[model samples]
Target chain A: MRNDGETIELIERLARLVTNEGHAHGLKPAQWEALRYLARANRFSRTPGGLTAYLGLTKGTVSQTLMSLERAGLVEKTANPGDARSVQLGLTEKGRALLPLDGMATIQKAFEALPQPLRATLGDGVAALVTSALAARSGRAFGICHDCRHFAADARGPGQHYCRLLKQPLEDAEAEQICQEQEAA
Target chain B: MRNDGETIELIERLARLVTNEGHAHGLKPAQWEALRYLARANRFSRTPGGLTAYLGLTKGTVSQTLMSLERAGLVEKTANPGDARSVQLGLTEKGRALLPLDGMATIQKAFEALPQPLRATLGDGVAALVTSALAARSGRAFGICHDCRHFAADARGPGQHYCRLLKQPLEDAEAEQICQEQEAA
Candidate 1:
């Protein structure tokens, strides 16, 4: 409901990106999706809970991805001794083994193929943007620009502040919108 | 492995982008991940094969996403008339109903949030980029530049040509690499 067209497009582009990389890396898109979540996850089983919140999907979907990954030995699921209702998710040796950790040659080849300037331009900028976006999702309010933070007042003029990382300003309205990240930053 | 620290960083960043959006949309990351894939799908059903190729997700992983979406009534599965062995994936009315078609509002809001120059600099450029990216992926090519009709060898330079749409020069090596997209494109 809160998602606008631009947000949707951004989401789709991101998804395509993930799909492309995951497939190229020989991992399922879901596996990649799950893996990505796991990479950011604090606890293993909590991964599913995060997936449920971020995707607007059902518990069953999360369960299925976890199940398959577990079966393939890409991830391991263990009973949560602390929480009887939850299970922990973590990467298996095989899963980690299959993942070139750094990603396989194709990914490197892709990077190598790019011109140095292009690589520099896209590489750092994209990485920084991703990090900022990811961090924003954590529940804690990011304390960079007061007005720019989502909690800041937006009734004022232009209602936007420049982001050092993005090297651009976001609308005041956008700042007010909650970031979807799971943990508190 | 060929993945440079930068490339992994970029990919991880993209993942964060996904997580951020998922959190904002009140969708769990995994559910949102599935939704993102479904939106990019050609057909409503968006066969597991298509997902496999497009998202780089494994069969099992895609299957799980599909199964979950199906359970949620966001997507439905129908037998592939052409290939009895396969099933065509299609979005449910519910799914289609949730999607933001062009994302104009979000873009407009985002654009308005920026400085006049930044808006001007990125406005048309971003739109064109998205269009080119989408057009290039019309289920014909795998979103590769070379395979795109716009991709042409520069008559003046051995590896130089202009992407008719992006209006950028395309080098020969870059063009060749993009050819991989043609297989899926």
Candidate 2:
């Protein structure tokens, strides 16, 4: 347990660090996280409720973050065209534009700089921890479209897949986006 | 790069989830982090400025967080006896009592549940990432006392080490706590 305690503390320290990544941009860490999630989410997972689930935060907190992003013109709430009572969230052009400059890139660059073999091992280890944590929390995996059990090879088109759950066609690009409803294949 | 991207995202997602851990206890995740850091910090690392550097956040943000913790009676700020202009932070009895119930326990338990070999690998990976991120930021390592270059194996006492930087003797327990001034031995 002693060694395990050290490991947990290491992870926790890094967790605290990621919260400061958004500081330089004059945005709260949560706001930066929300923007990143919105940009990477699939159409069905771009709602406020989806965000609340993904962040594991209260709806009040999620709503407040969304409101601040809207106030800053980085995110917008739009009425769902298909369901009048529903709402959909989308990043404003500014939001999409700012994604490139996010502190996340700095971290990814650090990853890229690692030796290839170490990077591979590091990826495997991180993926395992993420899996273990999600299982412990009983949370959704929120994985990419192609990784979902509902993805069907329908011959819809080249590099296209169909979502049996949503009954909608998904392109290659969309298949790489994360969805709230994703269940691993 | 694709795998690295996935790994980085996994780490970031876990990071965001960690911020929500303190929600049920009426503490912002950052506040909980501060409490944890203060509790585990060596005497020299338990001040507002030390905390700011440790969290890699602005002093303004750290001061604001400290103010909230003070109002909540979870933390106390006392003027340093050696330096009237400096302040030292300590957790209240209530604060110490609440730590066992902190959301950090859930994640730590998840790490504990892993098989021993996997836990070792996961720890290695996480430690590597933390090191990489800190290097990318050019931040201090903020490691434990025994690992510091200044740890002198003092012959004056058993299981006691002298700190060259602080010019102080450290107990076995204190040598295990994180210190702001620690540099690799």
Candidate 3:
């Protein structure tokens, strides 16, 4: 069996390789991360503050990254309807178009080629590692809505769900998207 | 079975989480990466050019990262005896002492708790993903010396090996370290 040190080493190398791949499309590594987060986050998790928490970066760095993305026409910001003082963020058409063609295509192909059981095992192992690390550091999990403790199922409706904390109905699609307020269920 | 998209998403999330973990220890994400690389890299692979290739970053970015590490007194540079024009990098005592106590301690504990087979499977899957992504992008593998095509085994010695690329004999420990010039055998 491989020792703990080797496992940590492999994880570190994989993380670096994945990040370097994200740098290929005229974006810095951090920019790619922010863009990807915005793409996955639900509407409620689309603010600069959400990004700052999700990326675990300084507010200044996240703001700078957002400004750069806004300048490139890849991301747009609008005043929040509920609170005009705050802003909401979303990817533009160009950003959405670039998502499917990013450097992760190769990684996706590699993952697709793995055996089903191995793929599941890998995912579980990685998820456990992420959960443990974040818990140790008191970092936010930013998990999918369906997995959060606040998720409440609607028994009468086939696909409807609710966020008990937000007091809002969640569509099927939104339930699958990541949320900044997610807590383990 | 999880589909390809889900597999890719898990890996991306894991990568981001792992990278964020490195940001907690008074080092930026990139600085921790560079320092970790220097700690595990062989003597021949400990140069600025090697780091640039291994990290797949521009010369300027790698230089800036190295400068930051130097300023923190975590890394030291000296002229390479084999080639005066190039310099070699090594971690200071302060750096070596910090390596064992980095933010990865929690990650290591998580990895240690995994069943051995699951751990091996996860490592293999990730390595395959990294190798495929790197190959698709024409990036260096930066693999261990023993895995390189240039690795030459000494029939008479029990553990001695040599690197044909560097024309240098490799200690057993050195043969286990990652090399910037590694090409799969």
Which one is best on lDDT? 2
Tens-digit lDDT string for candidate 3 (A18-80) = 787776678887887787888899999999999998777789989999999999999999989
**TM-scores, all models, native as reference:** 0.43, 0.92, 0.87
Q: Write the per-residue lDDT of candidate 2 for residues B1-185, one digit (tens) a residue.
A: 34667888888987866666667588887888899998999889999999999988889999999999999999999888899878999999988988888898878777777777778877777777778889988888888888889998753588877898888888888889999998887
Q: What is the lDDT of candidate 1?
A: 0.51
* Two-way DockQ contest, 2 vs 3, winner: 2
Per-candidate alpha-carbon RMSD to the true structure:
13.9, 2.2, 2.8
Write the residue-wise lDDT of candidate 3 on B34-98 in tens digits. 87889889998899998998777899999999998999999999989868899999999998888
What lDDT score is found at residue B64 in candidate 1?
85
Docking class of 3: medium
Supply every candidate's count of residue pairs whose N, Cα or C atoms clash at under 3 angstroms.
44, 0, 0
TM-score for candidate 1, residues paired by index: 0.43
lDDT of predicted model 3? 0.80
TM-score of 2: 0.92
Query: Which lDDT tens digits does candidate 2 get at residues A1-185?
Result: 23888888888887876766766478877888899899999999999989998988788989999999999999999998888866799999999988888887877777677777677776766666777778887888888878889998645877778999989998888888999999989
